[model samples]
Target: MLSYATIGVTDLNKSEAFYTELLAPIGAKTLMKMDRIIFIGKSMKEPMLAICIPFNKEEQHCGNGNMIAIAPGSIEKCDELYNKAIELGATCDGAPGQRIPDLFYGAYFRDFDGNKIAFNHFG
Candidate 1:
């Protein structure tokens, strides 16, 4: 139902570098780039994540209750991706673990620009 999700950022180049490397494990790369935005994903046909400067020309800030959830297909992969996010300088929102006993394994972190992301696996 979603084509892409955009996260506002202050530095386009820095955010682009951060996301491109962090998501590389999932086969996501920079599919497209514009002056103020870069789209990253496995393909344009799949859901993509966009990091960009605000169109309104104001300062970029994260919303109070917004997050992007990604399914890595397994608990172990989720853990690996979560650790990669940390290695890329993201701050932890939650550590990797089962969130709903046997049903959900997930981890959360905020990127350099404070955009929240979840590496999740559902059984």
Candidate 2:
């Protein structure tokens, strides 16, 4: 039921670079860009993930218990994407592995802005 999600950042250039690499393995590309925000998705019309400077012109911070989960299509893809994320400077929250035997496999990390993100597959 979700349509899109956004996270606030202090540095738009840094956030853009980080997310461009983080989302590349999943084939998500830039869908739009405005002065202080950018939207990315598999297609322009699909659900998007946006990174932006806080509209209120205040400091940006990560939410206490919020995360963005990305499905990379399969267990292997999830692992690959997770590795790529780390290589591009994301800090690991959880390594890629089966989280629920034969049911869920996933990996977690925090972006440069400390926003949590995940890649997972369900079987």
In the range 39-89, model 2's lDDT, one tens digit per residue, is 988876677899999999989989999999988799989888888889888
The estimated TM-scores of all candidates read: 0.97, 0.94
State how far residue 97 of model 2 sits from its true place (Å). 1.2
Tens digits of lDDT, candidate 1, 1-123? 889999999999988888888889889999999998899999999999999999999999899999999887789889998998899899999999998998998899999888999999998
TM-score of 1: 0.97
lDDT of 2: 0.88
As for candidate 1, its clashing pairs are none
Task: For each of the candidates, give the backbone clash count.
Answer: 0, 0
- In terms of TM-score, how similar is model 2 to the real structure? 0.94
Q: Stretches of candidate 2 above 4 Å error?
A: none
Write down the worst ten-residue block by lDDT for model 1: 70-79
Error of 1 at 28 (Å): 0.4
Give Cα distance to truth, residue 106, candidate 2, Å: 1.1
